[model samples]
Target chain A: MMSRKVRKYFSFTAFVLPAFLFYFSLSLLPTMQGLFYSFTNWHFMNPKYGFVGLQNFINIFTKDRYFVMALKNTFKLVAALVILQPLIALLLALMIEACAKWLQKIFRTVIFVPYMISTIVGTFMWSFVFRQVFTQIGSSIPLLGFLNQSWLSNVDLAFWSIIIVSLWHGTPLLMVIFLAGLAGVPVQLKEAAVIDGAKPSQVFWHIKLPLIFYSLTICMFLTIKDAFKSYEIVYALTGGGPGWATQVMTLNIFEEAFSGNYMFGYASAKAVVFLLIVLVFTVAQLLLMKRREVEL
Target chain B: MTRRITPLYVLNILLLTLLALIFLFPILIGFLNSFKSFQEIFLSTLSLPKSWSLDNYITVFQRIKLLRSTGNTAIVSALAIAGIVLFGAMAGYKLSRTRTKYSTVIFLLFISSMLVPFHAIMIPLYQMASKLQLKGHLPGLSVLYIGLGVSLSIFMFHGFTKSISREMEEAASIDGSSEFGTFFRIILPLLRPAMGTIIVQMFIWTWNDYLLPVLMLLDMRQFTIVLSVNTLFGEYGNQWNLILPALIMAVIPVIIIYIFFQRYIMQGVLEGAIKG
Candidate 1:
């Protein structure tokens, strides 16, 4: 009886081991390996590597201007996305909720179409829209002639262009998420508020906002994480070009390792820093939001 | 449910229509210019295609090997999703059912890795893949995805398995069913809702992934749809005649999937956002 109980407990391993094998070799082991590699000078071409300790991290902080620039650009994008993406998505969700049922479906479907398409595909299409279609529209409508500026080539404008494209590609899914949250707001609560002579906007602020606060936290978390990990839209749209004006951390780390730099060890260090920044921001956001959630 | 359509409601509809049009403008433009000749595209992208010709589509189809790449993508996505759902469900179910120190540690191991960005691990993963000779192969890439994907799938299933009652499994066991037999017969069927969410999410992520494929696939023939289209874009810079058509073709599959699985996809996204 004792042996049978022991054998029964061991049987659970059969269910868990297959998935664990793949995950350990590919995900968990590589993570530790990456941290280990960060402390060494592991060049892509060179087989031999030596421990470099804190040199790579120090250099990234003090020496590499490009890394610094990428850091700044990443923060800029994240800030914009965290603030603006949810705001737009929330407004869209609120408006869609106001529409008739059938119209709501059409609006939701149309807005989300861009999201279903890959970021690269959508970014490439927008590149055409910015270059050719903008010029055509600018020339045809004299009042809108300013739209003909070199959107991708210009440094300042290129950043905005990436933001515009990212928002276009990203906002719809958040909108759908917000729509779900809004749907969960109990109808009776709103009706009760309205019976008390609360206007629609007032009811929204008092009743709906508190109810959907959880979704707000989720959107904020998703936006911050996504903005930090953003690669495809910027990579395809500008290839981190216009003189690396739009480079983010992922693109920087990728180019360092692959695009002729071959600084695998140094890139690994950048990857570590990238991971830390994301972890800090997202974990902090979650903690903060969880506290706020309890308050409400 | 009937209510008066007030002025505020009219304003809402008008605003939603305008935003939706803005959302669809680039896609609509890409579709229109895909049918136009090169010079026509340059002349006025907003204008209708003069002839609605299929010449550019034919060229793009042949140039990018769209059919072949699409097949490759489909194969990769299918294999990866199958592995993820099976392995994820089994492990998630077992982990949720068990209560031991090792189980807690194992579950934490899977959950904690969800926060690590892929770029942080890409270099080491690539090196590991090369060492194992898993690089540059479709099945190997699917295996990598299974590894990368199983964490989230496990998390989802684990959360979902809690809501499933243990009575069925207990009953099956008392009826002389073996453990594996009970799991397959009792727990697996009860896991369908979680499976639907997992399958939809996994399919979209694997199908639309670009960076992983770009890193893993070496040969043009093995290239997925996005890779083929990207290759065309690189080789023919500013040649909208070729690029636009491929762009249009690349998005058609996802759009179709969205149309069919809109409810499931939206629910999956909502669940992922909230729980993940």
Candidate 2:
């Protein structure tokens, strides 16, 4: 009946309106306002401001030295993560898969413990290790004296420290994803490959790699997004210290708006630019990876 | 069946054990050092604690108001996650079951917003929070989290609802059950796995979130666990005894949660990554 149809439609509205209402006001509206604010000179404190058109964006590209440094650092970190995250994750997944069942579970659990810890906590713990514990060890054990360098103070080492800490915390989730992908690899296919006198390495190269390429794509995409958006690790660990040597884009944006300078409009522009870069990078990576996924 | 171990298997076990040790070294060191006095830690960061004392923990507990902040975190995470689950479930199930243009549009609206990272909107979000008087309010922050979190929750539920059949709802409707009754009594109970996955994922997220709380929580008493521990770093520079104990206390609960819900958490990670 028409009444039944009307009631059904009303139920759909009833179900959806609650979430939509919350999402629209807080998420979507803020995002849209951010986009609008990007074009205006909106300071956090000063109420009187005028339209700036593309001035904020132009300044970011040409004049903002800090922004450029942050951009360079973000790219460097993203590049490292894109390559190393998948490599280490896939390697660990393969290693775990080859283990006996119980060992696999234990190893997976142990590695994933870091990922469960808050990034702030994990990074702080690593900070102590890099700052105090490593130095102590290096002094006590002469052979390990190389570890005594100012890990978070020296410019180059600090960058790498961020990468190391990021990888330690990030790799496990991707490894688990890789594990899931590897689990889906048919036992029959691998067994068949082995029966055909294929070597272990050969089976991995010819069979397992292709089958898990989808997971590889997903991991790469996630890595790029996370790397570009990386904040807490660098923020809590180094505070972009030693003269902003390791400031990433997110940190740069936060500093621009909140830390000292209340340049809300300029920060909005930087944020928009950062968002565009993330979108372009992730979308491009997804496209590139999609083409290489082996059809089963 | 009895299986013969190979040289390769021996190598695998050794390599895995080594990697596991490397992964766990920081936490192990932190745990050991947390029990040490400041002077003891400074004397030898590598050595086992001279005395396994609870002094630092007790000091940290009082300093950070551990129970109060954790209770605050629990309140926020619980309220946000509950709203997300209930709202996401209802909307996602209905959208999946409905065959209408409006459903498609609404679904698209939810999914597309997932791409906007928090950084992009954080400035304006700060403004909105102040305007709405949600700033520095704990329950208000939870409401904001529900708003921020619902997109992904809805996305997951939408994907999950596809794997569920509509026949049960139809059966219930034929039996003259109200739609709300049918959903709450039937569809929801069957959505336990997806619910488990989201609950674990969101709990970890909301519990450990630092940036949002930092932005929203203005008062010291409003600090969540991570925020409280973060203050330790600033107030006690290189005071390893206090900082390490607080960090340990902050991190240990989530590890315990992970131990219990490891499967769901990992599954959620895989599902979220692949789907997103």
Candidate 3:
């Protein structure tokens, strides 16, 4: 029986081996090699790499202006995503649920559609809309001229532009998540709360929010992680330009490794730090949220 | 069930319709502009063209070689999705059923990887690709995408497979099915909905992917639709005619897929969002 069990285990391993091959080759092998390369100044275009212990990290911390700014910007973006996106999504989900049945799917479909488009393409389309259409619309309204600024060109407004785009693409799905969580909130519980003289807001704050915390936490994790690595949209829209004002970390790393010069090792160190930051947040979220999944 | 459509419900429907328009209007703008001549596209930025013309499409087809790029994208995306579904389900099922330290760690690793930004490793991955002589090869690019996408699909599949019954697999085994046979017979068939969900999502992601394809496929012949269309931005002068037509070509697949499989896509997204 024991030998048979071992044979069964081998069979199962065979079943998983194909995915493992792809995963290990592309994801693990490259990343592990990247960590190795970080210890050496392995320039991609050149062969003159030699071991340099903590120099790359030391240089990044000491000399890189963009690195420090990237960290601060990333954390700021993360804070905004963690706090605002899910809360707004939850509120929208509530409003949509109180809506008519026929209209709900339409709203859900519309909201999620942007999420499906190329983030780069979508941001570009929004650029045309932002630079031209929104300006045209904003200027027409009296005293709201503050909104009419050159959004993509402005250092101040560009980050907010990226944030708004992120929210627009992201919020719909979170809204849907909240809607699904709403489905799990027992009707009997809602009715009981109503009978016990709970107002709608009170019931929602006390009941629906607690039940939906799992979805909220997942949304928060995704939002923050995505915010950490926000590159493609910012890359496409600003090209990290109008004076590096909207330049995020990933873009900084990309330019460092590619266009500026081939500092592959330094880029890898930056990447490893990024990986660590993402790992810390992910682990923290899983620990915080997994306990609250409430297996039911 | 017997209630009439109230004023509030009417207002909600109107609001949703307006919002859906906002979602749809960009693609619609691209589509409309594609039909218009270059001059008209500029003159009337947002309006119906008087008549449809295929000149822009023909020009782009001749120039960018749309059919071949579409073919390459289709082949790569199909293979990648097939790999993800077949391999992701197997791995997900195994991890979900077993509770060993190693398997649990692997599962966590997969989950946490979703958090890690791809740009971090992109430079070195590109180097490795060059070294292995895998750059510009369709199969090589497909493999890279499969690796990148597996984490999310497997995370999803793992959650979905846990809801499958032990009794069903046991029944298959009792009837002379081996463990492999039982998994294939009982478990795989039961996972069609999830398989559909993951495949469509993978299709969208892999189809719209820009950065990897841009870096890898250095030749014009191997350009995916996105790579082809995005080159518009770099062209000396923005030929709205060529660019708009190319954008249409890139998006049509997704729109077609959306129309047919919106229900499945919505369900899949909702499952991903709420469950995991």
Candidate 4:
């Protein structure tokens, strides 16, 4: 007979093995292998490569101006999103919360409908608006003529166009999160504050916000992570144009590895850098936010 | 409270109404203009179409092979969800129950990789896919989805499994039920709420994902709806008529699912975000 300890171990293996195999092969192993490839001069065309020892990393920093620019653009986008999305979502959630019960459901559904659409399709739809509808509106309406600006083509405008679309696509989720947070804010506490002569703003500041701090952290975390990983919106809307003005790091990595040069090793190095940046920011954010999270 | 209309309330409602209109603007325009002829759309972009027409829809339906691509997407999503739910539940349950050092190490190994961005893994993953002859294959793609997706699902499952009592499992074991049978019968049924959340989360993610499929799948015959729509956009850059309808069609399925499962979808989002 098998020993009890052996049986326990066997059962554990039997249960976890399938998930581990797939996760290791596809997610874990590839990540480690990608890190290993970053130091080499691997290309898709040639099977042979030699260890270049941080050449790719050096190039990304010192030589590859595009990668640096992409990194800057990603940070810009993240900074914008980190500020705007949660604030707007919170404002909207507050408004919706103040509304009558039935109106809340209707408004919530309409707002969140955008989040249901695939990013590619949603971006394409926005492109159509920017290209055709805006131009038409500009020609007809004298006051709205500025709407006719080439949104996806002009370098300056293209960045804002991506920001606008990302906000549009991303805010609904945060809004819903804020709404959920709002639901957890005890009505009695707000009423008590009001009875104690606290104004609406005062009540919100003192009572509601503190209660929803956990949700705020989650929303901020999601927005930051998503902004760093922003791809499809930029890919579909701008294609990292006009002249790489809107290229985020993911797009840069993709173009480096797949689209043109097929520089797998170099791209892997950028990916590693990208991973490290994301990890640092996410870890720092979580650590910082977790401290402030209040228990009910 | 006074049953009277106040200026501030009026202002709030008007502002919210305006915001709602803005939120719905893109979808409204996409749907309305999908019926318009190109000339009509160009002439009055904001106005309703002169007459509702199905011409664009018909043309795009034929050009993009919308039905075939939708079928491929459904198959991919179903297979991936099946694998994710099954494997995630098994592993999460086992890991949550077992408190040994090995289990803790394995659990940590899975959880620590949760923040590793997909972009970091894409290149080598692509290489590995090619090497395994799994690139450009749908089943292979589904397996990859399972791989990429299971970590978070397992995390969710692990957290969820801790809430249920362990007495039932012990009783089942004592009643001569095998471990696998106990999980499948006793434990799995009790995990319905989590299962629902996982199914919704995985379905939307797999169904809506664009980047991985673009990298992995090559043939036009195997394109998902998003891939096919992207191709149509590239092929007909200036043809807004075709593009708009295709976008609408591509969006319709998810919208339908969302309408049906709005409550569950929202709950899933909140639960996943909070727990994750």
Ranking by DockQ: 1, 2, 4, 3
- Flag regions of model 2 displaced more than 4 Å: A1-5, B1-3
In model 3, how large is the Cα lDDT of residue B36?
A: 81
Reference-based lDDT, each prediction: 0.91, 0.90, 0.77, 0.91
Please state the error at residue A212 of candidate 2 in Å: 0.5
Q: Between 1 and 3, whose TM-score is larger?
A: 1
Name the runs in model 3 displaced over 4 angstroms: A1-6, A136-148, A289-296, B1-17, B32-54, B95-112, B166-179, B236-241
Q: Model 2: what is its DockQ?
A: 0.83
Q: Every model's Cα RMSD, please?
A: 1.3, 1.4, 3.1, 1.2
Tens-digit per-residue lDDT, A1-296, candidate 2: 56978887788889999999989989999989998999989999998888999999999999999999999999999999989999999999998998778888999989989888999999999999999999898888999999988899999999999999999989999999999999999999988988899998999999999999999998998899889989999998889976899999999999999999999999999999998998889889989989999877
Residue-wise lDDT of candidate 4 within B41-82, one digit each (tens)? 767778888878798899889988999999999999999999
The CAPRI-style docking tier of model 4 reads high
DockQ of each: 0.86, 0.83, 0.52, 0.82
What's the distance in Å from true for residue A185, model 3? 1.7
Candidate 4 reaches a DockQ of 0.82
Better of 2 and 3 by TM-score: 2
Candidate 1 runs further than 4 Å off: A294-296
Each model's backbone clash number: 0, 0, 0, 0
Fraction of native contacts (fnat) of each candidate: 0.85, 0.87, 0.52, 0.84
**Which stretch of 10 consecutive residues in model 2 chain B shows the poorest summed lDDT?**
B1-10
For model 2, how does the per-residue alpha-carbon lDDT over B1-276 read when each residue is reduced to its tens digit? Answer: 223698978988898899888889889999999999888888999888888889999999999999999999999999999999999899888888888888899899998878787899999999998988889979989989998999888888888899988898889999999999999999999888778777877888899899999999999998999999999898997999999999999987888888887887888777777876
